[model samples]
Target: MNSNSDVTSRTVTALGPQLRRRKSIKHMVGEAESNSGQLRRTLGMWQLTMISVGATMGTGILVILGAAVPIAGPAIWISFVIAGVTALLSAVSYAEMAGMVPVSGSSYSYSYATMGEGIAWICGWCLVLEYAVSVAAVAVGAGEYVNQTLRTFNMELPVSLAGGPAEGGVVNLPALIVVVLATLLLVRGARESAIVNTVVVIIKAGILVFFSIVAFSAFNAGNFEPLLPMGAAGVTAAASSVFFSYIGFDAASTAGEEAKNPKRDLPRAIMLSMLIVTITYVLVAVSAIGAREWTWFVGTEAALVQIVGELTGQPIFVLIFALASVLAIASVVLTVLYGQTRILMSMSRDGLVPAVFGKVSKRTGTPVAGTLITGIVVAITAGFIPLGALADATSIGTLFAFALVGVSVMYLRKRQPQAPRTFRVPLYPITPILGIFACLFLMSQLGWHTWVVFLIWMLVGIVIYLGYGRRRSRLGQLSKQDYIASHVGENQ
Candidate 1:
């Protein structure tokens, strides 16, 4: 027993002061204030909701219908509903945690407060894949739409520059350009990026609404006859795919540090965003199915535009759809790039990742180095990888991160009941439990390859933690007095 104690004491001593900071609610709030004061708190509830909606609404809405409908038939509409509810539950859990913790790192920061240094590192690594790959995938999708729009005027890039080698071309130059531009915007600072994002959001949402209305004119009731042709399993499979459309709801949580009243706004923004996106998704899916047969979607480039063009019997509709897609996807790349940098900043502060990732530009108050590195990685992926594979990998990482957040909420509630929360999950254990199970179900539906990639990525995170994070962590430095004082002040 004595020998075991000695070994444990040595192990504890080795974790470093930063890793053992024992962040209390007060310190968490203080940290958020310090990092985010440079950002203007100009967003109200509605703008916040719109930001979430803009981030969540993207290529998935335009692309997934074709991919999902073949699996679930007309019943894919129901799958959208299922996926939306599951996402909403998780969003609610995130909202509560964001409100209570009010920190910028999303799951990474929350996990640190509740699960300790090691788990937080893993969560942060998962987010790297989620945000970076998402930006790349969205950029690739945007590139396709841009090409489609250009084709309206009989203008097209050389085949080599338009697609990857796997697609019988060489490089996706347009996609690379999009990622690089988004990175530059992010490095400039939050205010400008948010404004650009807001404009993109409005354009995208407007186009989606326009598509819904016009597509309805071509609606044929006959398309509804074969609902659920693929059965319940098919609907579930489609739900997993449709779940990708909801990816950006957590973007609101990442702004926990910047929100003027995080406790009041964060949860509201999350749920409201989920609600708006769900409605838009259901409308778009129903309209698309009513406009065309399901199988026509397979292997079709610019599927949504094609659907609208075919339904309306006018090529102009395709041009409009393509333009809308470009704007939406651009917003996704921008928001995701911002999220990646912010999470890295949080990890750097905790000393779990390189300190350079956390370095904020004194003038801009943005993570310049981190954003540049992320942009470069995204550009490489966009220029080389296939969109389908990148999208699957992103979904797997995001689902894992979401499930972890749900679990963290439950863990914190039970472990720190006295901790003040500005907002609480409406259904308590049921909401979080269902959220975790839902995320797990979606994750399992991803291809076996995605799981393998995720596992390998996680192993890399573990190695990094053991090699560096554990030794440099802020948590390790906390004395008993510091821990008690931090918690006590928050409680008061």
Candidate 2:
């Protein structure tokens, strides 16, 4: 057994270096030379952290909890813990990978360098699920808050203008409008976008804290009766649903190419943002459940506002928080739309997607065309689809991307063991293995319809990869077979 194990280790040691031939580590000091790169690297550790915070801390906290509470009952906070623990497992793995493969594509770039181009393309397509679809889902939540705030003035946004077709409306104009607003901000450039996001992140994080404190004041011990009303399966199912809330925690990794210090900052921001989100989410969920009966959460679009209004009976307070939710949700749209375009840009650079998606305007140093196009598509989807369906789809995509990132990390650990990493997963293979299992377990808890949608999306991705990406992949000359043939005997 020892002799056989020794031979296996020797073969792996010989093959590892040959397998890892791809892009150089992308940590330019401060910023890339103006002539060297397209995207500007003006984002600091604070800005990068806020991007993750702003993007993930939105609609999930403000709106989705209302939907999740009924499923998990008063123990909804436990669902958050279930999901956050799963996310933490993946977040640490992401931190390790981001530190090593600090680039714009996030999981997609990491996969390409570790798993090969085909898997990388699939990862990027899944990212469209995570970033693009979540943008639309979160925008729908923002539209609800918009209508709720307008109602305070005795003016209501008509369903045709503010609600999705699934809700018996023609088009969700507020949803479209919100996406347009975020898109415009993204077109202004990354630095300006980051600054705006930082401000909103601080404001919204504060708003959540304010909500938790106020909720505790109204807390009733009776609300805690029968914590798991539907049983443990229900909490797991609700966790699957609320996993959508953690969707954009990887937004920091997507900005790896634009960070002032990608290696150090990317890992720090990824870990920090997820920690903040998990702690806040659990606190907020527990506080909310303590304040309101779980069954009353159903069909609530403005849950946080409703909770505050019921507790204080003050129209002004409700109005302020509702307006704050609008600003808060808009930040999610801004940061997520930014992440979506950057992922497309990275894929474009790799020839998996079109060059137009990768184009950066010299004036703005941003992907203007790509951002506009992404916003338009997301807007149209947001206008037609309901939040519940979109949220589930986004969760599946997120879990899929996260699972692959876990795989990517484990793969790199074996394939490039000596790679320079500013951070490492705390438990190495065990952490990544658990991350993958946790993501898959949660995904299984989702409804079958979500799986069907994911399959259809994968079919489309496969066809595109076969017709386009497989032919034009920029990693063409460095084909695995060609490299092996050239180096095998010589190295031996």
Candidate 3:
């Protein structure tokens, strides 16, 4: 049997010169400041957990119930369970990796340490798609809810400023406004983002709990009698649609660098947030199902608000629901925007993306340039694209990234047995394998157009890698250094 020392030696030697060069470049690129400006380390386990919940629970639970219910009927509850379990598995995988690496880049940095450069670039690209597009989708959803809320007071924005291009509008000014506000908050630092997120999360949760209580009073047992009206396949399909709600679990992982004790805190945050979200979802699903027959849920936008209005017989409930939706969706945009900028910063550090992305503002100690660029792209997407289309596309990209992270955990266990890990996936091979399969299952249920768009995005990433990233990569340089170092040591 190989001794521990032997394993350590092999691991170090296997790092190769390319890794060293990459490390050197990362150090150089990250030299701007050790302090992340005024970003306070005030976030504890509770705050981090809430941040995850804030980011995940928004438009998904409040808005998506309508879309998903039509597909699976009362079995939408089962869809929530299925999606929750699958997401938990992947969240555990993320916890382990984030604990081990404890960096700002989330999956991108984890892949860099375990899977090498080319794979890391692909992971980073996928993350950009996942975070930026999801933010845009959430922003668009927020705009709709805001517009709906305003109309209740007899005030209305022009269609061009409220709706997307697909809905007979040239641009969505409200959506662009949402992205810009989130960007400004994020540029200030993590502490401000956390404070704002915490407040928004509380508001959103209170509204949901209120809805659940009020709607439950009107529950009719007969409403759920034909629970599986669409069968098990329908439940599975609905679960796939519901999986979008779970995409933000990775949001906590992106804060690895700012986390007080990353290894200990990350796992707690991921698991706790997921568990809370699952419970919240179950409550909302039960209330929605019990309030009315499953079929009535079809074709409704902002379905939770509709459920509330039906139960209370008051338009005031709709106004409150819309307000809750705005706060929740805005929180999602902020968290995801912060995540995308960090991933870009990591890629820039590795020389896989333009160095400008890696630049830290001396005053802010944040990746201001990357944040601005990401915000601009998301604003444009939200301004022109419909929420439904963007949601599907975001889900595909997110599932792909989740699948990669799960696979990476298993791969790293075999390839880097000696790497330090503060937390391990409880079931090891089984956990990660299940996570990979679950992600694939969800991806399979998405429309073919989503798959086509995802492929095109990946192709674009590959092209950029070949044209620029490959030549400038610090990984290649590090490998060369390791080879030379080994030979020199041998000669001596």
Clash count for each candidate, listed in order shown? 15, 0, 6
Per-candidate TM-scores read 0.92, 0.91, 0.90
Q: Write the per-residue lDDT of candidate 1 for residues 1-492, one digit (tens) a residue.
A: 355543454365545444444455567778767766554455566556666776789988887777778889888889999999888888888888888887778988877777666667777888888877777877877667888899888998888988887777888888888888889998887777878888888888888898888778888878877887888889988898888888878887777665667778888888888878999899998888887777666666666787667667777877877887887887888887887887887878876778988787777877788889878988988988776654677777888888888988988888778877878888789999998998898888877887787787788878888887775665554444544666774322
Question: Alpha carbon lDDT of residue 356, candidate 3?
Answer: 86
Query: On residues 201-319, what C-alpha lDDT tens digit does candidate 3 reach at each position?
Result: 89988998998998899988898878898999899989988888887878888776677777789888999899989999999999889887888877777778877777787888889
Output the better candidate (1/2) by lDDT.
2
CA error at residue 123 for candidate 1, angstroms: 1.4
Off by over 4 Å in 2: 1-36, 385-391, 477-492
Task: Show the lowest summed lDDT stretch of 10 residues, model 2.
Answer: 26-35
Q: What local distance difference test score does each model get?
A: 0.78, 0.82, 0.79
Better of 1 and 2 by TM-score: 1
Candidate 2: the clashing residue pairs are none
The 10 consecutive residues of candidate 3 with the worst lDDT sum are 20-29
Better candidate number, 1 or 3, judged by TM-score: 1
